[model samples]
Target: MSEQLIQLRQELAENPYVTFDSDGNGVSRVLDVEWDFHALNQNKKIIFFGRIAEKYRLDIQSYLYALMQWQKKNSSSGSHAPVNSLIGSKSQLNILATRWGKSEFSLLSSEREWKKCTQTLHGVGNKGTCKNLASVINAMLKAGLVSRYVYKRDYIQWAQPDAGNGQAIAFPEAIHVSILKTVVEFVETYHPYRHQISAAMEKLYTYQDEMFNAKLKELGVSALSHMQMNSLRNRMSRITSQWPERKAIPNFSFHRSGVWLGTLLRMCFICVGLFSAARKEELLSMNKESYDDSLAAVPKVSGVSTKGNKGERICMTWNTAPIAKLALELAFDATQAARRYSLKRLANGYQNGLLTKDKYDAKRQDLESAFVSSDIPYDSEALINKTSLKFHIYRADDGFNMKEFNINATTEDVEEFDLLNPERAGSLKVGGGLPKLSPHDLRRSFVVFMVKNRLGNILTVKYQLKHRNINMSNWYANYSELARTSQLLMDTQLMSEFNEAIETSAVDAWDEIYNVSDTLSGAEGERIAQNKAERLAQGEEIVMSRSELLALVRSGDKSIVLLPTGGYCTNRNCERLCSLMDIVEAPCEHKVITDKAGKRLSRERDNLIASFRAINDMGDYANELILDARKKKIVSIEPTLVKHSIPFDSFNDDIKAIWS
Candidate 1:
């Protein structure tokens, strides 16, 4: 075996507790190993920094103070008794007098001058902070100005440098403390703080410092070289902020085919989010209760059905359910359409169960946007399945078949599949493969649309959008700006004459469009005046009341509704009918009928009763069919599709197609 491989084998043998797998790639080398002896041995002293820090449940700041006290008590000469050989006075504290210290190091300034400088620095009084003290002491030691020695096993004392060009020397206890401080600070700042941290413990910083120093020693680096050790710790602590977000809905455009597929998956997730609007963590942590599929329609979103929140967690999730439903259904439909059209597109689908995952202890996966391109997992071949028997057969329409679709699982299954074990969910089976979009953005888009449409109150918006902070849901404000401005404009007018002018101006513009003269001659003006008088005598069409219009709307004689009320039907093709009477009296068979109270009645019921009377004259057979169908499982006759065709002349051929 090669030297590197041999060294690795030795390392494995020495540290049998450590595990590594080489697979068929052959033996791998162990690059480095570090151990902390001081951290391991500190308990034999009067107090251990790690133990005190952990036991008291103190933060790093307070732990530093506790460590200083422990050091002071244990450093006295009489207290230097070693209970176990594991720890002796190998580490000790020393205070040197300025005059002797200066003479020993051949200082330009006396020790008194240095002490003055030290006193003025931060963390000089009481137990000085480790970082600050360590920095000062390290500078002094590097300058060859101070020295120290342990006179007894327990306590440290000062000493003069040996009189030679190559002088042997000792370091001050304060210098060691200073080094320890730097080490602790570095560890505390590490990106993922080393798991050793315990808020309950005292002297956390001190313990980390000792551990770091010991680690350096184990690596054959001079732990006594505080400057080098500090630099190394800093390097180890550094980390880059490359991963901007844990979950990313991928950034594919809505126009892309992948986007359609992605959007569908994302839409499903968004519906879940908006419907649940659970806290971010909770949303990610969701289980089965987050959705209800009891009806054929979209599931109702309710937080009462969610988990992870404290207290009753009872809050009504009120948002525009219709738009939410539309966006999701559209996304799903678009995806199904894309996959059905192409085999290559099928290959681009997301992994099955991508959104379904277990919540606990599992790593959160990336949330792709409504679209993403294909890429293999860089670290493993586990995701590849080309050789599997299931992979060779194409299933472009697996999830799209509603007749064969099954919605058997409950909230529990969703939770298990979606939140808990995301990795497992990521591996789910989909006929065409996973769609591009993920679930969370579906919720975000809902919030975006709600705000866009001005569909709900701020509280309702926040709940439906599932934002914890009201401020986070400001995206919708821009969409409602135009409507709000119009409302404000309508509520205020400078003068009644201005309103009349506005009305008059509209008619004048219409008159101008019909080629009516802007300036007519005397005879022409006289003719116009005569026509106006004649029209006034004849009287104009009657204006309907709000109740009358509402009745018409309810009756579905929506077509032929008046010009102004024409906007109500979202379907673009319906005729604009202003009144029920206009529809009923027209040649068209469709009629809007009203009761004596002027409320609308169902056309089906009215027609059914009429049919019954006509049928009684023929026989009891028809009545029996209706009765038996309702009362028992009788063989029912097939119902025919109703067609209502009107003559071409009856329609206002001049009117534009409503859909256009």
Candidate 2:
């Protein structure tokens, strides 16, 4: 083993969490094999075990490398290392360690072995996993633990793209509208008596323990039997039957009341998630002080984004609609008993000297978290799990009859929903069950709705989604069904935007031909220039407003299609299927070449001339036809370049020497 590898192994033996900084200061991360990423709000841990811990031990080096890289990244920019990335790295490394056995980095040098190992991972079907594994291997290679030649040859040459897992489908428009309407109606119905319902729930919570103890004492037993517990629940329900908020609460057993209230809380969570486009962690980390509507016009929700803030919890604020304010209020009221129970426990723990000051402070911060599990005898520290949250969301969805709300899905809506969900396609009908919902689906649907309606672009939506880059924002908004359907059903505002885009293109073309360029090319360009000259002779300015150009385009007197070759094609009825390669060769009379097109032509001419010279320099007789075709292409671009006063080299004696 190399000296660096021996040192890394020794460090791992001493401390599992050791990481070195620029000043050689050792910083420890997690002290256990099962890392708890509490800041990430994940329910699971990144566990290293079995082969990763025993025979192979590749995880030691890979983990050390990941920590160093994370520290380097954090030092350069204040971006947090995502727990998901670490989990993915651990998973991929475990697979590699299992496949290669004790050979480890020795087997990685062989291209055949690398292919064999990577093929086994193809079934994993995650491009991010492949990237994670590659990052660790590359880091090892840079640290001189693996051969650098293998890094350049084998690792870079392999390609394993994800076939997609189909977890990112956006909710259809009909379902989205129905969910919002259902949540809004439910919140409005119960919001008026929120205080009374909270008080009643608190009363039920307080009486449950007292009644249970009293029943145990009366039965002369320490614990109640199954039948005894059921009888006590009935007695407690009868006792609260006369409460003023009985009508507001759902009709359920007193012990199962948390199920109904939890559903209400999840509905409010959905409302905030949908309107604000916040991630699941950001939404779950919200506290009582998260929402503010003092400005009335622009209400905002505050939370910490742990994704890219360099391991520091940076507070981010999202502007939301007024309905989000109602959702926040409803969520606060729904978790009232749970919050009270948590505070009471914290107070008792601190007073009895059971908890240190730091632990008490940490638990106190959790007390203010807006969402929690609503089980009776509530878990003060446990957040709601995905399964229970989805179950309640589904229950709320199934209970809200779409027909009563007059929500009828159109044929297009059903077709769009099917396109998004191919496996369950044709299962959604006009009045059938709604598709399964997830928090991510709401986020994707939000992006699709905003982009499809032209409310914002991908970059603007990135801020709302809390994405680190525009690429992820693009992925969330990649609803192909919406894009395909939008063309067939363009609304008036969309059509106007389309027309405005065309007018803007035409105005830019005309502006270049009249104001910027001293001369122009093509038949249409010459005619427009002569017309502008005559107008100037008659003491009239040639400037035109976008509205006037839009009128012309709408009236069918003018048309413009911006070409990829940096010019405009004005012949609306022309039948030439021209491409970038053959654009200069096309004999279309309506082509208009402005200064921008002239510059583009000049660059193309230079590139063609360089290719011609390089091929001729090879001194091969077989290149005659290729050289002739490229020479003609270069010749074809010169007229437009010369007409617009763009300078270029003519084929003279100096250039002809290459053809010798």
Candidate 3:
């Protein structure tokens, strides 16, 4: 993907609805949509003071002015008036500091006041929070807003560095690919008809119009009643029955099983996060109408992404992965429904509920302006709440009743609560039972599976993850390198068995690996058998750790490679060596045989020898077909029998000279 597309995809991953709360300062605040909007705003303050404050007053008017008000509210909202009222007034700043008890910009005449200011900070909060307070204080100093005049170095305890660098927590933890796949499957099945439903809606409006035109041309009739239209549609359906036809009915697993709507919604949330590899904020907060089916009728999710930019498209799924595209469509579908519901609910509360006309109209006007101002094709009554998902509160009692005054519930309390504390009706059995998964783990699972399905192609994973840098994505994928190596070894074992069945003409011999055949081995090889072979081979150990195991596998030494599976080496060349990092990890066709591998061949050779001899004794005059089949089977098993150690000289000159 191009850089522009990657950036767009990442931005599209943002949650669309901006939930707002007025912090008693006559300005609304947006929360939970950005990971660290507080710190992000703080950084912006630094730049605006140093370079942009005076130079770009227009830009600062909306952003910087609002930020100061927010900071003031955090410090002294209960007792004080608005923050801007005391901006350049030193007397008001001091009075504000007294009411606040501890302030970042508290006036400090002597050295003692600054020390006391920091002392009171740590007393009220832990080191972690104190660190944040110290940071804001420092910003005030740089912005030339601080009245404190003291040595900055003396505030050592309060201004100490964070506990650790954020590197440890940089990359997200991914769930198993199996669990993720199951979640995706559930989401797809749960809302399988979303696209069909949308298409049916569009078709409903246009099909009648088209039908009238067709009938007018063919039969000289221009109009049809609703009954006639229905009849004609049914007839068209029957006539096209012999040809290929698309059914509008849902044909997914959930429809058959009939899962609850809440469970379906929860799965849809997870599937979107897991498949998109988007940050938690991106998944939880989505545009009320994020799905666009304009691109060849495939739904593409679009939204405002909040990773280090304003109003940039965060992330989106392309035509590349069908499963991902479907997951996003369902999540967006839920969002569309939720937003419409919010609008109707809000308007009803304003019109019927006990509220002043002015208060009701304030919210009504806010929503109305959104529809009028934006390019989003919302009807004049779409309430895009700060949250895409909403949970209704209940009064504690013997009976359930939704809490009252919910119409005025702020964004802080009106969260997408289903993901946080989802009600469980069914068990996932991923591990023990599935834990209530966080949104971030879904993103991690997305990155991890992208790496796995591509077999450790880091670049492909990075692009899919939409990582700003490769390091974080690489850390997430490579964290379980040992696990990937273990899979490689398993692949080798499987391929070995596959080759064994092919060479010996016993097609079901390798069926033991899958335990599918009647004659398949249950516990094929005992630990004692492995131990005995190891003792005979001079106690050579299996490579264990990731680094050592990877080195041994790639060493290109005859001793380095283990005979985990039976060898099928002939026409082997030393020039070709396998890399541990390569996507193809199965046994090479031109494999080289070693002493340890010979042990497996010897055991197989004895089994074949016994079977051939027994068949020969019973088949002298049984039938021509049986005798010919047994002979051909013996011939197929003979070459591998020679590759293993045998009495070559004692055999006839024909066998001895066959090596040439």
RMSD of each: 30.6, 12.3, 22.7
- lDDT computed for candidate 3: 0.38
Determine the C-alpha RMSD for candidate 2 after optimal superposition of all C-alphas: 12.3
Candidates, ranked, TM-score? 2, 3, 1
Candidate 1 shows a clash count of 46
By lDDT, rank the candidates, best first.
Answer: 2, 3, 1
Summed backbone clashes in each candidate are 46, 4, 18
Q: Is candidate 1 or candidate 3 better by TM-score?
A: 3
Q: After superposition, how far is residue 587 of candidate 2 from its true place, in Å?
A: 15
Query: Per-residue alpha-carbon lDDT of model 2 for 1-660, expressed as tens digits?
Result: 666667666665655543323344443343444443333333222334433555544455445444555445546563334556555556666666765553356456568876676665544535444555677667556655665343333343343443444555666776677777887887777666566666766777787767877777898987777887888888777877766567656552344447666666777778888888887767776755688888667789988766665445678998777777777777776667766765676677678776545445545555565665566443322322112221123343544233334456677678777776665567568766555556777788888877876878888788888777888888787764466466446567877887677777776665666677767677778888787788778887654555676677668888777776556788887667554345346556787778788888788778878888888787677777677767777777778877877777786412333334
Worst 10 residues of 2 by lDDT: 383-392
TM-score against truth, every candidate? 0.21, 0.62, 0.37
Cα-based lDDT for every prediction: 0.30, 0.64, 0.38
Instruction: List model 1 lDDT by residue over 1-660, tens digit each.
Output: 334224433544543321122222212121122111211112121222232223222222121222322333556541212222111111111122221122122121345655543343322222222232343234334323333211221111121122112111111112212322332332223212111111101122233345666676677864336676566445433421122211122322222213223323333333344444443333322222333456536456433322212211343443233333433333323232222222222233323432112210011111111112212221122222211101111123442222222233343333322332232343223322222212333344344334434655567766665557777565433233443444345555645556556445433332331233222112223344456556546884323334454454345443222123111112226453533323334322222111210111123323434454455445455365543222221111001001111111111111111122
Q: By lDDT, who's the top model here?
A: 2
